[model samples]
Target: MGIHWKIKSFEALSTHELYDIMKLRSTIFVVEQNCVYLDLDGKDKVALHLYGEFEGKIVAYSRLFKPGISFENASIGRVVVDANYRERKWGHDLMREAIAGIKTHFGESKITIGAQLYLKKFYESHGFVQTSEMYLEDDIPHIEMKRESC
Candidate 1:
């Protein structure tokens, strides 16, 4: 089956949708990555959520932030694709949808993200250029990247 995409603000998310989102995030960011940091950082209330569903499950997910939330420009973060679906290259699809979501929802062309160091090329393919020196977040090497409005 093909992926189904959805974008919703915090209030628009149904209880089940919210649960699945948090569960997917925890599965990847906390358990899979072995990173222990607060996932609920009080940002969701103001951010836009983008997710892709497959077979009634959330297989891809990301969050979009308006300017001044995570960066001076609009931003995309919490990018994740279900481990079961990663081999299918849904990460790229997720990003493409996320870029569009940022442009459509926020009407902002410039987007910034603090991406994991290893995935620099993945983000680069989406037009993100490294804007800051490598740094560590949650003990994971990360770099700030930016994509100007196109």
Candidate 2:
């Protein structure tokens, strides 16, 4: 199966779309990860939401921020792939579009991300390089990474 991609601002999100995004986030980040951090960090109001849907259900998601929004540089956050569909590898597609969205919409090639430690190589394959030491966020180890351009 292939993913149908959508990118929109918080205000542009329909109630249903927003619900699906939140549900999926909670499912993966909260329940599955067994973490209790606040998912709504007030950044969504300023970020662009990117999600992939299959058969009317959202299975992957991420939020994109312009430079100076999430970090000193444009960033990608809240990356998640539905546990049920991980074997399908839609996470890669979600990331490829998110990177392209930054260039196409924000005219930025340099991007930053606070990625979970376990996915360091996954992010590396997409051109992100670790730039900070590992630290815990909501009890999950994470590291800062940057993609200089392209």
Candidate 3:
């Protein structure tokens, strides 16, 4: 038994599921990364949420947006894995599920992502190639990357 993957619309997530999602996100993106930025950017209302649970804990997650919501192409963002699960390839699993979800749900194959620079190769492995020069988002180096339809 590995990660139990779930993708839900904003209105479908239960209160407890939402809480766990936020807590895991803040733990990694805010506290662990030491970044002080608004976590609730108001986009979750229309985005599709993807989450993974292992041993009853939510350990991996990301959000997907339809075309014209986050970018010209359908996009994936807010990617994170529990600190404890990083060595187990769950990050890769999250992205694979997310990319497929975008295509399956949005009917789009081209996807864009604002990828942290340190993980450029990681995103590249999922077919994203850098499309913009380095820029700082929340004080962390990031680059725009896109994966075109195969």
Residue range 1-150, candidate 1, lDDT tens digits:
899999999999999999999999999999999999999999999999999999999889999999999999999999999999999999999999999999998899999999999999999999999999999999999999999964
Q: List, residue by residue over 11-118, the lDDT tens digit for candidate 2.
A: 999999999999999998999999998998889889899999999899999999999987899999999999999999888898999999999889999999999999
**Pairs with steric clashes in candidate 3:** none
Q: Cα deviation of 85 in candidate 1 (Å)?
A: 0.2
* Model 1 pairs whose backbones collide: none
**Model 2 misplacement above 4 A:** none
The residue-by-residue lDDT of candidate 3 on 23-128, one tens digit each, is 9999999999999999999999999999999999999999999999889999999999999989999999999999999989999999999999999999999999
Against the reference, the lDDT scores of all candidates come to: 0.95, 0.94, 0.95
Ranking by lDDT: 3, 1, 2
lDDT of 3 at 40: 98
TM-scores of all models?
A: 0.98, 0.98, 0.98
Prediction-by-prediction clash tally: 0, 0, 0
